[model samples]
Target: MFRRDAGLMAAYLVDAETGELLDDLTDHRREFDLELAHTNIAGDLMDLDASVGLPGQLDPIDLADSLLVRYENLWAELTRSDVFDPEDQYLIEKRIGRLNELGFDVEEMEITTVDNGKQVKMVPRVVEHWHHKRRLASLTGLQVQENQARRLLNSLNRYRIILSEQEGRDVPLPVAAYRWISEVFNPSVQIIPHDLKGGLDDAELFHEILEHRWYLSEERHQDVGMPYAAQSYVDNVLRQRHH
Candidate 1:
């Protein structure tokens, strides 16, 4: 059943992924549908598996509901208090930092002076995740998670510095990205065996290589290059999965 909302028929209870009717909205009554598809919800909700790393078998609708509750609770905590001191210069930065750490960007917000200008009230009108991933995609066209993008970006910046030093001039980001993609990223990714591709994507594999490089550098008291690090990871670490 559907209900008229603003002169439109809308579903009250439906399968989110399959869009199958579960209940009619006309009487606000629940209807059970047994033939709906079992796939996960489409679009951003499907990313929950990779983002939250939810283990074991779980229904998509249950996962989506849990995430919704989590976000709702976080929003309540962030905006419930309207008694922030306006005199603290670092308060805004602190809030923004906290939001970023929680994997959200304040897309739109409103700040108002309250209590005769003694206090401040802030409300985040819009929030977005994938902040680093969006920027990285725009620059390098490589889609990855926020943490993975950050690691890849650090490596790209290092590659940029290397290029500048080698060429005796400042290197632009696009040029550096092109070289880094060809030399560092592509080569490192290709070293992974085909059978092991199921474990991690290219960006994640590269991120692991960066971590391995740091560990090797610490052990040797010198920087271990990417090529050596990739080889060692594949030979010693990844090869065990096949056996």
Candidate 2:
């Protein structure tokens, strides 16, 4: 049996004769070999790279220690009474934001009403928000980090709203998303000169562009268009960072 924690894989061997479980696979060469073969077969079936000894392999114990530290920090933050409030109208969004800030995602939430007030509890299923990634990929064909996907979605919604107002009609979501990808996102990122990009990916570069745009707009006391913003970011921010 194989268990995965924080991207580290651990295999448990079962004795064929006694039906006893062995915690360490390294001691038993036959069991280790069998398990490795099974893992390769599974990876092949799932269309994933099955190559052994890939880079960035972390010790499971070290991963667990780091995770424990994170969990402790999260617990400390959540224990504060001001962290969450039942009366807050935007409680759900705030809760999700807090979790996202700590590299966690809520898969399910439970709310209970008591004599004093309501209690909100979130069930964490994974470290990052895979659902957001999947949703964004399906809609925009962009695979990005959870926070990056959320930011891009927000930008897409804003674009859709503006388009709807300009056309004097409601623009469908899929159509708006496609247009945003082709017209806004793609063009903006494409204008970023290769030298100015540093080592950041497209999604990350776009996000930084958006942030730069907001800063420029605030500083200038006017809304500078996306194209101008992208160019300015390339010339100003990315150029400096690359140097």
Candidate 3:
């Protein structure tokens, strides 16, 4: 069980049975050997190498403390909010932009007017880093990066339009997503030759095809269908990667 200690700001590997830090793994050597010891906070375990021959040269407790301090400082900045001058309304936008730059998306925020509207207090209601990733996984069961999920959602929307037009009725989002995944995303990816995959995963291939479609549309001054763009990308770009 991994639990965060706010005061320590570091996740400790605890001995579940003793309810204490698993400081010495030597006792558990028979169960779990430490061949490649990995610790969080930018792999600070490399600092231990200098103490190979010395018993107390590298203190794990001190290392954990340092990591905790760094974590606390970073967590504070990302979540901190403050009162701003009412006249500078753009301050909120600037803060939101900074949050986005730090890989967080503000879903909602609470704003309060104080000092008779002379100041504004704004706090994020929901702060999340995996906004698009969560949405894509929930709707389509496809785990992907935020940008890739957003682009794929746009493609799914276009597919919905085609479905609605063909059926002459309103098509639900889930139904459209299912059809898009089955008829378009799945087949398009599965058809890619194994050797020419070029280390590209399914989500990456989907994203690249979407980009290829945009370029083809730009050149022709109209939309090039997904099928055409995908085939061209696989045959020309992916196949020629080794060359």
Candidate 4:
């Protein structure tokens, strides 16, 4: 008969040999211990609820639209055709120039040339502009920046360089440009007041002034200094043209 005799729990089991023996212990697993283990198991089970176990749901329509837009843009960029005439060799450079102006650098291109001894033509197959503005800055030391900005600035700089040579004073190009901007371009525009800023942007206004000055110089058969050009342009043309 089984009975509690020594305040110890005992269980009968087969020993290492083929003989039976009684094992005793002072402490043993209780209902609470089994419940605690089961609680941990339940916590693990709860962690695997539907939200955690399920895959994410996405909007098919949105994803399809996004992919479609991506494909369209890529197709436009890669498939757009560029053509040129036999005499328009400069166009290739202009096309590459325009692309750079738009903040894009064509990395690779091959020019297909058609030669007939009398007629020669070339088409770009690969082209690119790389960190172009930065390179322009590093090399030129003057920063007008961006392709369009560089174009405008360089045009101004070229004229400035010519003006400096005409002056025969060894003045730096930037300084000359600054002088032209202040004396000729800016004051002419500013004279109209802030209410007229809408008629044209600052850059465009300056560009127009430059043109006016150029044609005036040609007409006079001499270099019309900024003072004469600014005064004449402001009174005769700028008021009628725009700010």
Candidate 5:
């Protein structure tokens, strides 16, 4: 009825036993499907899945263990043994760097005089860089982890710079990004044979290609282009890995 009324953009049929969507319905999902999948309710699913104790599923205890480790690590890094002087110039940068190293980005920081106005206390408002994941998805139609998005964006920025240098003018980011997607990224991905994809998604595959390119360039002491690097990656890395 919804399809007849043109109200349905897509539909899915899932196998209840396996929790897998029907293969035939894979193409029916809209562009925003992945974005929707990563919403707040995804956390609830993760928690439920963890508790279910299903084989090959994420373990709740393990998840808690990892979170505890990360919490302790952050606490250790942010905690100071002695009071810092209010005028310390490098403290902010140092704190920001530590947070960034832990896969966080500081959006705002509040530093106020404390300890009888002799020392300062610093509090940072941070994000886990989830915006990078969203930005990459919106721009490129690719959903990837935050670190992978950061890596891809770094590569895109480098591509933009080279393009600007060649054209002798600053190219806007969105424009350069489209060009990079068409010319560099898509082409490199196309070179990977379907059978040899090794179950990796597009973003992960592209990241591996970039890593392979860097490794080959360093080894050969020259800039090996994307095509060459991609072919080499397929032959050496992808072929060698078991699916």
Candidate 6:
């Protein structure tokens, strides 16, 4: 049996004497191979695939729900029209970038030349996201998020003069990232323990810690550092509260 949609190709063989199933393939054509004799079947992981949904099936409603959801999303993306003018070329790029940012890689834009090429209509043909994470890892050694890595690199750009001036060193970009991560963000984040911290994410926790540091400094009329801020947060705020 083969399911092209699932990229699954498998062959079933009946054991004549033992009345069992056997796999007879040498090389793999798909990620999984399945063998079944009546109700007996096994795939790579014994996948309960969609072919079970006959009129005599137990859960036909779940299958309909899944198909409805898939169709809904595809219909929304493909059929929905923003429908703008030719003068707004910047909006097209912005729209494309927004879709790409939302984890969709646009394959190509279908631009319609209406009114004999004077007017235009464009629609997205494809979209994909989560592409930047691997690319960022390749460009830089860090395996942080695409957005986080992008922001980190941007923040590092701001710290170029700091690296040159205070320590009197002009480091390379990768080394500078290391220095910034170690000296700035790491120490701040390291002060917070896993148990003491609430549901805040790492980057957000660091950012809030920085904000708390500034707030503590303003309140106490002194330069409260990250560690002190984290300590105070753990003691004064988190301890008193429950979520």
Q: Which lDDT values do the candidates have, in the order given?
A: 0.62, 0.65, 0.61, 0.47, 0.62, 0.49
Candidate 3 local lDDT, 32-87, one digit each (tens): 32222324422454445444532656565566557556655656656676565443
In model 1, the runs with Cα more than 4 Å from the true position are 1-129
By TM-score: ranked, best first: 2, 5, 1, 3, 6, 4
Q: Estimate the overall C-alpha local distance difference test score of candidate 6.
A: 0.49
Cα error of candidate 4 at position 130, Å: 10
Model 1, 21-54: lDDT tens digits are 6443432231111111213343345577557855
Q: Residue 121 lDDT in model 1?
A: 35
Winner by lDDT: 2
Model 5, 1-243: lDDT tens per residue? 112212322222334554555544342352244334444345655668867754677655565456546755666665443244433322333444465565445432333335642232333334432566887777787778876776676566556645664676767778988998999889999988989886888889998987788777667655677788889898899888844
Clashing pairs in 1: 1-24, 1-25
Worst 10 residues of 4 by lDDT: 117-126
Per-candidate TM-scores read 0.47, 0.49, 0.47, 0.32, 0.48, 0.35
Candidate 2, 34: how far from true, in Å? 58
Q: Please identify model 5 stretches exceeding 4 Å from their true place.
A: 1-128
Tens digits of per-residue lDDT, candidate 6, 71-167, equal 4575466445454443333234344445544434443333434553212223443312334445336544556655554444434443443454445
Clashing pairs in 3: none
Per-residue lDDT of candidate 2, residues 160-196 (tens digit) = 6456646767688899989999999999999988777
Stretches > 4 Å off in candidate 2: 1-128
RMSD to the native, candidate 5? 17.3
1-243 in candidate 4: lDDT tens per residue?
232423432233335555334453122433344445455645554455434652354434444445546655644554355554433333334444454443344433433333521121212232223243453355444343343344444344444434544574545645766665565455655664455445666556554555566677566654565456656766677556563
